[model samples]
Target: MPQMIFVNLPVTDLDRSTAFYEAVGATKNPRFSDDTASGMVITDAIHVMLLTHDKWRQFTDRQIPDAKISAQVMLCLSHDSRESVDQVVARAGTAGGRIDPNPVQDYGFMYGRSYADPDGHIWEVMWMDAAAAEAGPEAFAAEAAAT
Candidate 1:
């Protein structure tokens, strides 16, 4: 079986958070969801578990940081192309997410943008040229300089 990742996040409003994730291209996996939590599937290997504050406490005793004011972590998702990165960020904005909470990154061979969900969890969407990435930065720079 392939490895998979599930990112659990505390949400102020489960319904709103679920809707926001859906708008950003994640589908709800009802099989792993309940009133206190929703399993949002971003891809076959990537899942986001949106948990209510009460539900989140069950997993840990630590206090939940207000993501809007204090960031605990920033998640990132990679896209096939720069356009796809932009599209996801736009959809996030339309779904009431704060667009570009982090400054945009645009290297010739790579690009990235970020958005903060309604609950203020930041998600960065990025894209990189496969060949250039595989070649490493130094090699890519050498090639670019020659061209």
Candidate 2:
């Protein structure tokens, strides 16, 4: 199976987008670097292609949705604990990212929070304790089970 996951997203400003992603802890891949785009490396398996408006338009004929008005995609990542989620949330805010007002919490099992990058792309940061999660969906099947 192919191990890499590629996500191409349109950005109004590549430099600003790059800075925002870097602030969120993603690195840049020089192999795909150029005046037109930047490869924001999310992980060894994941890469987000941050393309300029013109460069992005070349990929599709449909109009680009104003992400600020409506988000087309919600990027999600998993963490190990709630503290980890809060840490990244804080980092993102300091780096110019916007945190969602409310977060979902599955005490002792899972938790998730949302944020928007500088380019207005939505990202949901989540945490799930494997041992706790291994208990399966029934663990959070209902609020009664959560407690």
Q: Considering every candidate listed, which one attains the maximal lDDT?
A: 1
Runs off by more than 4 Å, candidate 2: 101-107, 140-147
Please give the distance, in angstroms, between residue 87's alpha carbon in candidate 2 and its true position after superposition. 1.5
The stretch of ten residues in a row with the least summed lDDT in candidate 2 is 101-110
Q: Backbone clashes per model, in order?
A: 0, 0
Question: Which candidate should be chosen as best, given TM-score against the real structure?
Answer: 1
Candidate 1 residues lying further than 4 Å off, grouped into runs, are none
lDDT of 1 by residue, 1-147 (tens): 899999999999999999999999999999999999999999999999999999999999999999999999999999999999999999999999999999999878889999999999999999999988998878878888999
Candidate 2 collision pairs:
none
lDDT of 1 at 111: 94
